[model samples]
Target: MSNNDSIKKTIIVTVLLCIVCSVIVSAAAVLLRPAQVANKSLDFKRNILSAAGLLEPGKNVDAIFNERVVTRVVDLKTGKFTDAVDPVSYDQRRASKDPSLSTNLSADEDLAKISRREDYSVVYLIQDENEQLQKIILPVKGYGLWSTLYGFLALEADANTVVGLVFYEHAETPGLGGEVDNPVWKAKWVGKEVYDEGDVAIAIIKGSVDSSSSNAVHQVDGLSGATLTSRGVHNLLHFWLGDNGYKPFLTNLKNGEA
Candidate 1:
């Protein structure tokens, strides 16, 4: 073949090789996507049940979630019962336009780290015999050591005291900030009151609680060397539970709305 013809042949070969690789990758992704989704859903259900103090690992979560958990969407402003919406499908970025999901945030609401405008947040209301609500669980997500931490916070009927707090996902350092996931440490959060007479009272202290005060704030000692991670959790908790967080919704729940 002539020089130009040989060059052309080489270019054609390279192009074909690239196309074949791309097609193979695309096919593999398509084949694996469903399994990835299933695994994610199964793990999410497990974590949610764990946060609700219902399930242990290696246990069946689907049956328990179906039997004990009731999920709902609410108007944040009115704090009343509303139509059901899927939390997984809700677009937090486009939530401003959802007429039923009332909020003070305008169309220009900051699309920050977490999607603020979710059509509906996942709320797990646990029940007991006589069909009465026992624990009210709400999802909490905010910035952590290196990324946003997503977890669950279960509150007592009073809406002020926390019943349990558990972190399901976070990217903090393993030996330091990641201690937020430690069961022994998180257990301290149980029975901790979030606020004291309209003021934010909950805190993660650097050391042990004094043990002298009758009503000392719930204190989780900071990881010895993880200042940033500790600070991140502190800030996020305050931000999420404040007036802008779930304060309004929780207050209404306390008032016997939903």
Candidate 2:
């Protein structure tokens, strides 16, 4: 073949190869998208179950989740459930970034230091066979020592007592800030009172909680050697449970107004 003819042939082959590769990639993405979404949803349900202390060893997460948990969307400001948003498809993190769906936080009100906050949030409800609400799980996130920590805080129906707490995502030092995941540390949160006289009063103390102290009901033992992470937990709890967070929803629920 002449040099010019050979060059043209080479270019055509390269272009065809690129086109074929792109088609394959596009097809794969389309085919796998549903599974990806399902898995993401399953993982989220698992986290919710874990926070509610309903997760069991070797159990099917989907089955247990569907049987035990009910998902609902709440308006933070109004403290009311609204059918305007679908709980199954609502993405709180994504909504927080949307200008129309979120509100900017002031420095004083931003205890979690989350500058932008979503106006609506998803809450998980667990009820007994009688359909009486037993527990409510709230999603919470805040900045930790190295990165933001995202977690779920489960409360008893009374609204002030904690049932369980779990951090599903974070980027903190292993064995230090990472100790937040320690089952023992998490256990300390159980039965801790989150509110005092209608105020958010829970605190992740600097060290061990003093059981004899008057404020012991609102205190949980801090993560050993993870002061920053512990403080992040404290701030996030206060932020999410306070007036700007779910306080209105919780108040309504407590008053039977919800």
Candidate 3:
């Protein structure tokens, strides 16, 4: 047999080909990293704008976001606005996994089912030219039936009324829990009240809300056949809006302390 066709030669060629391919792939990843990061940032900005209902279909996302949004960091424990961290550089999701940056949760306290929560969270504020808050968008995440769902919850300045809710990432089952992405279902959250008489009264009910029911304003229809996911949504919302989460911040905000 010819040397080129020999098993040893063929093995050598294959190894060399793999080495070349690996180098190319590594180089491409390194060269493209900045673009990937930029795209991810752009998508994040879009999601924030979308959650606040401030996104215009044909308008420049960056320009519009810059014109209306003010990013700030909030101390979860104090419920106060803090300048200790740079809002632009803060990485909350990463912080959650760091013991120094976050706090561990007990089973009872972790209604959202996140094992740990960051000590500080970034919030987006949509303000008028006068600097008065219009809408406040807060980040939230929790495990669904299958995977962690990350999203924004925007509220009117009162902090009790929802402006919009959108999950930017999730791995829920298609046609079931995935219905959370349905525009029609998301629309149902637009006017929902987060608090009723000083309590977190909002809920994703098992069935459709009765329009005529007195408590309908705080109820959302659960996704059919997705009970666990529905429960996770309910729990996460409550956890985020309750005393251990944004409630203190909302109080400070209303008092002009945040």
TM-score of each: 0.80, 0.89, 0.97
Q: Which stretches of candidate 3 lie over 4 Å from their true place?
A: 1-5
The order of the candidates by TM-score, greatest first, is: 3, 2, 1
Model 2 deviation from the true structure expressed as Cα RMSD, one decimal place: 2.4
lDDT of 2 by residue, 8-76 (tens): 999999999999999999999999999999998888888899889999989999999989998889988
**Best first by lDDT, ranked:** 3, 2, 1
Candidate 1 error regions (>4 Å): 1-14, 84-88, 92-120, 215-217
- At residue 34, candidate 3 shows an lDDT of 100
User: Per-residue lDDT tens digits of candidate 1, residues 143-244?
Assistant: 766987778888876777778878888898998888888888787888888888876677877767776766565565676678777777776677557666
- Model 2 Cα shift for residue 123 (angstroms): 0.8
lDDT, candidate 2, residue 119?
A: 88
Better of 1 and 3 by lDDT: 3
Q: What is the lDDT of candidate 3?
A: 0.94
- Report the C-alpha lDDT of model 3 over 218-240, residue by residue, as the tens digit: 99999999999999999999999
Error of 3 at 54 (Å): 1.0
